[model samples]
Target: MNPAMNESSHTPPLVEISGLCKWFGEFSALYDINLQVNSGERVVVCGPSGSGKSTMIRCINQLEEHQAGTIKVDGREVMPGMKQIEEVRRDVGMVFQSFNLFPHLTVVENLTIGPIRNKLVSKTEATERAMHYLERVHIAEQADKYPPQLSGGQQQRVAIARSLCLQPKIMLFDEPTSALDPEMIAGVLDVMIELAEGGMTMICVTHEMGFARRVADRIVFMDFGEIVEVAEPETFFNSPRTERAKLFLSQLLGH
Candidate 1:
């Protein structure tokens, strides 16, 4: 077994963060945050609105720069202005809460843009990969339609398909279902659960405990800009160690 495996016997984390902190002028958004996501792991981070969950995930891909600490992806330390950042970005795909689809483009076009722009594939190949993921997300039939023509759930699914066309090794979902209607949330989550079962490494910042319970290997609890607890889903929900986590679970799970 690799010595770096942290109990599950998997290899070292595909993503690792240590002593990460982010600041905006006088305000601090993150502090002393540390986390790791082993390959094929699904980690769900849940917490209050200001808990820095989104910022932490954003830093993993350099979407948000951290003032202090180190983030390494695939064993290479993330550095600013380095060509390695592009490689890291290519290996990691992110799906935001808002669909972020191009309104002027058809779903197929939207999905092909990243691969085509990066010259990762020829136009024909990108389109083929786009359709494959669209089918996987159950929306291949809508490939010719523009973003506005799709339902909220369908748009979010398209967003997921767009990310998949990149053939990334890891996926980051920042509150992917937050902008959807209650009815739409489940559809998006269902696709995510399928993605998880397929053994894709995923780090999600979402408040949906049910989804966490269903698909997450571990749940990370953050509060006031710091990680408060990290536990397996069953232990996290049933036996949280911190009052902040308990209160958060109660508030979220409370009717």
Candidate 2:
């Protein structure tokens, strides 16, 4: 094995991105981005709308293709190639803001399909795993409920549980709480905090500064398709290095 592989064998980063760039037509959505996330590290990315924060996480799971640069998950490259992308996605799960559950299927059914189809687990085994994660997200009680029947918070928790059933090495969350009521946000954040505490590698795009402060090992700030700043939550929040970051924080924190 390569020395890099050997070193990673001991302490592998779950995901790495280098010189990442993405564009649509002539417009750049992300620019020359670089980042690494070690196994079990929790990172929160925040930026103003249209800053490419959502696009960045979407690329990690191959939901969006980067016109340039490279992304790796668990030492495997993620690219437009089908085999590589599928392999990477198998170990990397994503939860979206809209909670894309199957309205026709019950919660348990939604959670079981992916693992059974992709992981090739038997239905019995998949259901058991689904129940385990459903319990973890505190919604096993709603396992039989349809998506429309649950509150937004409950639905998001089900989405989390569905992703977990895949046994992904990393989880990517795109504005997971953005669509919820203020009162409902805490329930989803609590599950996310528990996931972080239990050592799951996670990359989340959210404006929830309190959640970032409490859970993130690092916070990345982006603007106009560029990563302007990356730091520990305390440093990023208290003494931002870039003027754009300061101005952004001013807007977020309200002076």
Candidate 3:
């Protein structure tokens, strides 16, 4: 019945990280990292190579474990060796730079396997879900083709559809366009932009400033294993608050 207590009872963020730290032998990949992503928020992470941008998001899905930190997804605590880790993973979908599709499987099969095997959905239902997502990505016509048969962009679209099959609450993209040819990048970005417009919560690690400006609600700049600045896209690109960010933007946009 206290006024201050009532005021502080706001909803928690959809994904929350606190005091996150990671080490590879003696090298600290991430240090004292903290971040929170809310429902339907699109966050873009940008930084130079080896700045721990990828490592930080990987920790969110537990692809790589952190030695110390607290990660909570949907208000459930996520820690190393937790039995509920699989549940956490199911809610967090990730697309890597590489397509990572099954070489021998058809596109439809690749999309359905996770739901059929993991969620125990019937084959009919899984295929229906697969086709729906494939259609959403504009690759339904290629659903019967193998990964080897599709162009790089089509293959990446399949990869995105595969993740969507799970109907995850959050999507993590680890440089989704970096592995594609320059001509192939636009297709993938188009699919991503469409997903953003549909209000999917997304955390992307990319150097594509154009995409960031167009899609991101906030831009997170990291350097030397630490977050250098966090700001709105307009502020981050036009008038960054930190010296590191200013220099980074200058070098990145210098051409």
Q: Give each model's clash number.
A: 0, 0, 0
> Which lDDT value does model 3 have at 181?
95
Which parts of model 1 have CA positions greater than 4 angstroms off? 1-10
For all predicted structures, in order, the TM-scores are 0.94, 0.94, 0.95
Candidate lDDT values, in order? 0.90, 0.91, 0.91
Task: Assess candidate 2 and give its lDDT.
Answer: 0.91
Candidate 1: clashing residue pairs, number = 0
Q: Cα lDDT for residue 206, model 2? A: 96
**Candidate 2 wrongly placed segments (more than 4 Å):** 1-10
**Which predicted model would earn the best lDDT?**
3
Q: Is candidate 1 or candidate 3 better by TM-score?
A: 3
**lDDT by residue for model 1 over 19-48, one digit each (tens)?**
998997888999999888888888999999
Pull out the clashing pairs in model 3. none
